[model samples]
Target: MPIVKNLVTQMSGQIQVESQLGKGTTFTVELPFQSAEQEEHPCGGTLDNPVSLEGKHILLAEDNAVNMEIATEFLTMNGMKVTQAWDGQEAVECFATSLPYTFDAILMDMQMPKLDGCTAARQIRALSRSDAATVPIIAVTANAFAEDMAATTAAGMDAHISKPIDFAALCCTLGRLIGKSSKN
Candidate 1:
């Protein structure tokens, strides 16, 4: 598909396709070789330690019980406090009622009953509180398409994280978005 092709091209790679009547098509992708150092140090130098989320408070807005529990447990294991919201409307309400700067970030599900993620995000952003505009609202959903990402941005979300969540990536993203560096 276009996504795979685009990824290959972005890596300064090439792709070829071959097909024959009554036979399955074949596709090949080739990219410039990378050394171990290049692979490890993607930025071409030593990488800083990933920021830690210890003691940070997070608002987790997810509808599914299993997902909420998993995400909550992971966050707690990483020393972050989690406040759960079952749907988008509840998420908006929770943010509205909370004290300013009480949350380090919000993980919002894109689909929910009562109100969708986009509407809730806009509502949160429209709040009159000081933290309304500043708080990071991250869309956490199954919609991983490029257009879906764009939709989250358009809806005033600060970030987008697709599910099933990548716990390490989630931590790093949260750290980047709202954490204070351990070096601080």
Candidate 2:
């Protein structure tokens, strides 16, 4: 429920939920419409050429199954390999156990059931591995405030991405962080 609401709001839409005892709930979503004149300035421009993340391996830590699937599909479409971690603890464990430099980057979520993105990042940074201090850990979260970014930075994350995820921005961030060549 929270994930759905967050994604909707992030896309500049409103969602309302109504429920009654012994009855199913109904969710109403209101999204802004752009007029023909305004259509020229669509939020994010359409991709004439999509960025390729070939040969990149990403560790994605997300609690929501739907969100995880969406992200994984997007990344995969861009030619990147994605590894899933359901929570912060699993992320930490995955990073700790993997070989040094195994993953090119990590996409972390701030809120999770066990541990948290911040704690996981700290733990990964603290690991005794060659890439522990250098691997780019990017926060993919719903926390979009200045303090949230500061917190992610303090936890050793290299970048912060707010949800709902913007594919173009995500591609650019990943490219900049990992020094990938532009596809177009």
Say which candidate scores most in lDDT: 2
- The TM-score of predicted model 2 comes to 0.73
Clash count in backbone of candidate 2? 0
Model 1 lDDT vs. the true structure?
0.82
**What is the per-residue lDDT of model 1 for residues 25-108, given as tens digits with 9 covering 90 to 100?**
999989997665444333223334445578999999888887788789889998999999999999999999998889988999
Error of 2 at 91 (Å): 0.4
The alpha-carbon deviation from the true structure for residue 87 of candidate 2, after best TM-score superposition, in angstroms, is 0.4
What TM-score, computed on C-alpha atoms, does each candidate reach?
0.71, 0.73
CA lDDT of every candidate:
0.82, 0.86
| Stretches of model 2 off by over 4 angstroms after superposition | 1-51, 180-184
Superposed Cα deviation of residue 109, candidate 2 (Å): 0.2
